[model samples]
Target: MHRTDGTRSLAGLLALWGATRLVLLLAVFKVYVFPGPDVTSDVLVIYQGWYEVLRTGTFPLDDVTWQYPPAAALPILSPALLSFLDYAHAFFVLALVADLAVLALLLGTGTRPGRTVRGARVWVAGVPLLGPTVYARYDVMVTAVAVAALIAGTRRPRLMGALAGFGALLKVWPALLLIGAVRRRAWAAAAVTAGVLTTLFALAMPGAFAFLTFQRDRGTEVESLGALVFHVARHFGWDGQVLLNYGSVEFLGPYVDAVSTGALALTGIAFGWLLLWRMTATRFLPHTLADAAFVAVLMFTTTSRVISPQYMVWLVGLAAVCLCFRRTGMRVPAALVLSASCVTMLEFPLWFSHVVASDPLGVTLLFVRNGLLVLATLVAARRLWRTTVARPRPGTPRGSAGEREGASHADADPQGLPDAADPPGLPDADPRGGPLSGARRGLTSRASRGAG
Candidate 1:
C-alpha cells in the first residue's frame, strides 16, 4: 500500500478501537458503581485500595498484597495525581493513555522502511477485541514498553535494552524482546537492562524483592491450560476443589501441587526448546528476533500455572510487533492470536461464573481459547523453523566460499540486515539488477541464452 493509504487505514482502525474501548469502559464502570453479579471489575476495585495505600507515603503497604515488581508502583501510584477524579476513573484514564501510546508506536513502526501495515492492524484490532480487560489491568503499560523495545531493536539497540530493563521491572516479560538482538547489540542491550534493573533494585531495595516471597507458595491458577487436567479429573471422580487464591482462581486439592509442578517442568522444557532453536538455526531473516520473542512468550504463557485474561494482552502486543516486519511469515498465527484474545473476553466477565462453576460453556470457552493459543504457538514455531533452519534443495549450487561464509555470519548476527545483493526471494532495490541476484543471475542468463 502507498504511505498515504496505509496511514489513513491505520488512523481509522485506531479511531474505531478507541471508541470500542470507551464504550466498554463506560459499561464496566457502571457495573462497578451499581455492584452487579453479572460483571465484576475486580482489578479497578483492587487497585483503588492499592492506590490509597501508596498515596499515604508508605511503600508496599503492609495491609495489602502487592505481587508486582517495584516499577509497577509508578503506575499503581500514578492515580494519586488525580485524587480529584476518584481512583477508578483516574486509573482508567492512565491505562487509556498507555493504550494509545502503544497504538501510536505500532503505527510509527509499521510505516518505517521495510515494515508493513499488518502490525498496526493487529494492535488496533486485538486490544479492544480483548474488551475492557485491556484498560482495567496494568499490563497495557508494560506492553507499551515492549512495543517501543521491538521498534528500536534494529536501529537503536541501547534504547531497546533500556526499555526492556525498565519493562522487566514493571513485569518480567519485556526482557524476552532482547532475545532478537544481534550478538553485539544483544550484549549492549543486556548490559543496559542489567544496569537499569540494578539501579531500580537498589532504589527499591527490600520491597522490590518482596514479591518473590509471596509468589513462592502460589498454587495452580484455575484458568491455566494445565488446570484443565484437574478440571477433567474432577468429573472423573477425583476429589479436588477450585477457589479464589493468590488473587486468582486456583485449584487446591488432591494432585493440585503435582499438576503445578508439571506445569513448571513444561515451562523449563519450553525454554530449552527456544535455546536449542536459537543455537541451531542456519539462516536469519529480519523478522527472526520478533518471531523468536513471540515464540518465547507463547511458551512461557501457555506452560505457566496461571493464564490470566490480561496475560493475553502481553501476547497480543508482542504478536502485533511481530507483524510489523514484512517477512515475519506470521499472518495466520497472528490471526489466531487475535482470535484467542476475543475468546479470552468471553471466558472472563461475560461467562466467568460458568468457569468458576466448571460448567460446559466455561470449559468450552477455555478449550477454544487455549486451543487457539496452542495452534498459534505451533504455527509460529514452524514458520520460524522453516525460515531459519530448512536448507536449500540438492543441486542448488551454493555460492562462493566467501559468500556462503558471509551468509552464515549474517544469520548469526541477529540484526539480519540486508546485503547489497537482493535476498533470494526478495525483489532487487536497483532496477538494473532485474529481480534475482548472485547464483540465480547466472542460471537466468544461461536459460535465456539456451532459449535463443
Candidate 2:
C-alpha cells in the first residue's frame, strides 16, 4: 500500500497513470471506435425518436418504449438542435458533450490525489460511444447527471440531490440514492432536490406521474441476474412460459406468481434498513454509507429483469465517484475494483461475440475480470468492517456528522480540504452513498489542504 506519509515519488504515480490510460484507450478503440456493438449502442434508440417525430408531431410518449423517465426526454433536443445542421452532426455533438461531462466531473475534483489523472484514464470508457452503438444511446446523458451528483455531493449535498434528481428523470437509478439521506440535514438536502425537479416535471410533463403507474403494469424480461435462478427450470423444458408472471422465470412457474420479485424486494429493504440502523446506532458513520451505496447499485443491477449492455455505463460513473472519495486506507483495493471494471468492459463491449464462441477465452477472461473485483470488494468490506470495530482516532474520543463539516468551515479554500485521515472530500465522493463524516487527530499539525 502507498503510505499516507506521501513519500511515493511523483514519477511512479505518473507511470501508473500512463499505463492505465493506455489500457483505457485500447478498450475504447476495441469496443467503440472499431466496428462492433458500439456501432449500434446509442444510435438505434435515439434515432428511433426521430422516426416518431416524422410520423407524429413529437417524440413517442406515454408508451413502454424507452421505459425512461420524463426528465431524460429533455436531452434528446440536444441532438435535435443539430437538425438545422445535420442530424448525424447533432448526435456527435451530444455524444461528445455527454462523454466529456463525465471526464469533467471526475477532473473537476482536482484536489483529490490522482483524481484528475485517474479520472482522465477512467474517462476512456466513454470513448467507446464514438462507435455507433454508444453514440446513439442516451447512456451518456444519464452518466452526466450521475457524475454531476457525485461531484456536487462533496459538501453541498442539496446540489448532489438535485443532480441525482435530474438523473432519476432519465434512468431511475439515481432515485435509489435518496435512501442514503439519514440525517435530518441530509433529508433537507434531498427534499430540496425533490422540490426543484418535481416542480419542473409537473410543469413540463403534467402527466408524468401517470407514466410511473404505467411502468408498474409492465412485464419483466429474462436478462437480469435475478432471472439466472430461474434459468434451470427453462433448461428442463418447463412449459410455464405464458403461465408465469410478467417477470422472467418465476420460481413458482405461474403468471400469477409474484413471489420471486416480492421476496427479493423485501430482502433488499431489510438489508438496507439493517445497514442504516446498525451503522448509525453504532456511530460507524461514512464508511457504512459508501458500502451501502455500492450495495444499492448491486441490488438494482442484479434484481432488474433486464440488464442491458448499457447498464455498465451507470456503474462506471458511480464507481469513479466511489474511488474519488474512497476510504484513504482502501486505495489499492479500490484500484483493483477499477481494474476489474475496466477489464470487464473490454470483454463485454469489445470481445463479446468472440468470447461467446471461444469458450476458454471467454471463461478465462471472465474469471480474471470478476475475480479481481471480488478481491477488491473483499478488501473494501474488510476496511469498512474494521473501522466499524476499531477504536476512535486519538484526541477525538467522540464525533458528529456536523463535526465533519467543521474543518471545511475553518479552511478558507473552496475545495473543502480533506479531514485528518485524508484530503477533504476524498473519502466521501461517492455519488449516492453520501459523504464521509469524521474528525482528525492532529489538525493543528496539518500540511494537506486539498480534497485528497
Candidate 3:
C-alpha cells in the first residue's frame, strides 16, 4: 500500500536498489561488458605490459608502445601477481575491482558531512560496470584513488592529501587539486603527502624518477573538451595542431600555416597570465577550489585537439565532486553532465561505426549531441548568474572568523539554498574561524551543503 505523503520505506528503496544490482550482475555474465579486442583501445596496452613486467621482475620501459607513468603501472602490475591466471582474465578481474572501488569511494563519503550527490552514488556504481570504457582503459584504478582523495579531503585533509599524492604518482591530474589547499593548513597535508609519495617511488623503484623526464616527451595528442570540436572541424577542412597555453583556449584553427604557430604562442601566454592572476588573486577554500578545477579542466578540454571518450569520465567525476560540496546550484548541472555522458559514451563506440557507415544518420547524431551540450552550457551559466547570497539573520552573532570570499546561500534564512538572488559562484562564506563560532554551530560537514 502507498502512503499519502509518498515517501517509501527504507526496506522498499533498498529492495529496489538490490534488484537493480542483481540485474546488473547477471547482465555482465549474460552479456560481455568487457569484450575481447575488436572493442578495446590502446589504453589497455599498459595493463598488458604490467603482466610482462611481473613475470620478468622489472619495470617495463614505455617505449611508445607503453606510455603511462610508473604510478599507473601499479594497477597493471597487480594482475601480474596472478601468474597462473590467464592475463585477459586477470585484466577483467582488476576492472571489476575498479568498478567496486568507485562504489567504495562513494560509500566512503556516507559518514562525511556534505549533501550526497543525490543519486550519483547509484549511477556511478552501476553504469561504469555496464559500459565499454570500463574494459577499454585501466584508468579506473587511479581515478578511483583520486576520487577517494577528493572526498576524504574535507574530513581529513592529511588523509585526503596522501591519497591524492599517491594518485598523482599514478596520474598527473590529481596533483592539480593540491592547488585547492593553497597556503593554508591543507598545504601542510599536501607537503607531507608529496614527501611520502616521493619516498615510496625512490625506495621501491629508482626508475620511476626517470619516468617523469620521459613523460615530458610523451605529451597528449588528444585531450580536453575542445578536442571534440577540433576533430569535427578537421573532419571538414580545418588544420594545425591544437595545444594548451596557460590552461585556457588559444585557437589556431582559422589559420592553416606558419602564422598559426605564432597565434598559438600568443594564445598560450594570454591564457597563462590569466591563470596566474586567478590563482594569485582567489582565496583558497573547498568550494572555490572544487568549482575552479571543474571549470579549468573544461578549459583544457575545450582547447585540446584530441578528445578520447574516456576523457569525459574525468570531467564527469570532477563535476560529481562539485555537486558533493555545499553548492546546490551546481547539482543540476552535475546531474545533466552525468546523464549525457552515459548516453554519449555508451553510444559512441557501439553506434559510431554504424552511424559512420550510414553517413547521414551519423551526421544527424553528431548535430543533436553537440547542439545539446552547447544549449546545456548556456542554461547552466544562466542559473549560475541568478544565485545571490542570502543575508545573515538579525540576531546571528558576529563569528570569530572573517567571512570567506565567496558568500554562501546558506545564511540564517530558512530558504536554505542558492538562488537567482544568491551569489553566482561557490561562496567563500567560510571564515577561517567559522567552525568555532556559535553562529554556525549546527552546520554539519563544512563541505556537504544539504541539497534540496
Give the Cα error of residue 308 in candidate 1, in Å: 0.3
Candidate rank order under lDDT: 1, 2, 3
Give the winner by TM-score: 1 or 3.
1
Q: How well is each residue in 1-452 modelled by candidate 1, as lDDT tens digits?
A: 67688668767887787787777678557753322232335556677676666665445645335777667778888877787987777878888888888888887877655567678778877887777777778898889888888777766777877887788878778877766566565557667766777676657444566676677678998788988887777778877888778777898998888888999999999888878776656455456777888888988898899998889989888888888877677888889989999988888767777887777888888889999988988898888776665353345343434334444443422332322222345432211211234665565345435433
Question: Which portions of model 3 miss their true places by more than 4 Å?
Answer: 1-37, 41-46, 54-58, 81-84, 108-114, 117-119, 182-185, 199-289, 354-452
* TM-score leader: 1
Q: Model 2: which ten-residue window has the lowest total lDDT?
A: 242-251
Clashes of each: 0, 20, 21
TM-score of 3: 0.65
Report every candidate's CA lDDT. Answer: 0.73, 0.50, 0.49
lDDT of 2 by residue, 1-452 (tens): 56543335334544554454444334333442553444443444445453454234333454444445666556655556677755545665576567667766665564354343454444554334323334446776787787776565545666767766667776778766554443344446666766777677667554545556555654443333333334434445654442223322123345423634563684477456547534533223333443444545644554454545456566556556555553434455546645655555565556765443334554455556546644654565455445443333445443444334442233212343433334454432222222233443233225353224
Order of the predicted models by TM-score, top scorer first: 1, 2, 3
Better of 1 and 3 by lDDT: 1
C-alpha RMSD between model 1 and the true structure: 6.0
Which tens-of-lDDT digit does each residue in 174-280 have in candidate 3? 76665444434456666676677767756776455555545433322322233334445556766545453322123344543233343345447535743653433
